[model samples]
Target: MVKVRLWGSLRQAAEGQTEVEVEARTFKELLDRLVETYPGLAPQIARGVSLSLDGVIYREAWFTEIRPESEVVLMPYMTGG
Candidate 1:
């Protein structure tokens, strides 16, 4: 299982859980599993979120490989003007 950290509204949507464990081999699978496990996160996730894999952040690199022990962080997208 990969370790996933949630932030902002994602945490609130996930019932205030800061972290979760999920089984996935790729980034896309991770997102799918997260939404499956927590249906409420679907809308936010679909709108857009940033993913951090082993300290690297990705906006839409779904094909990124995720190992069982990968450190992952999922958070809402940030924009600055």
Candidate 2:
């Protein structure tokens, strides 16, 4: 299981959890497992979210490999003009 830190509204959807764990080997699997485990997180995940893997933030990076020991965080997607 990979541990993920929640940020902003994600914590609310995750039953007020700041951190949670899920079984995932890749970004896609991680998001899938999140929605499966926490139905409340579905809508926000569908809209889009950013991922921070070991200090690197990524957007829409579905296949990114995640290590068990890597730091992972989920936050709202960011956009700039």
Each model's TM-score?
A: 0.94, 0.95
Query: For residues 1-81, could you state the per-residue lDDT of candidate 1 as single tens digits?
Result: 898999889998888899999889888999999999998999999999999889999998989998887788999998898
| Native-structure RMSD, model 1 | 0.8
Compared with the true structure, model 1 gives a TM-score of 0.94
- The alpha-carbon lDDT assigned to residue 59 of candidate 1 equals 91
Candidate 2, residues 1-81, lDDT tens digits: the string is 899999999999999999999999999999999999999999999999999999999999999999999999999897688
- Which candidate's TM-score is highest? 2
Cα lDDT, all candidates: 0.91, 0.96
Error of 2 at 57 (Å): 0.6
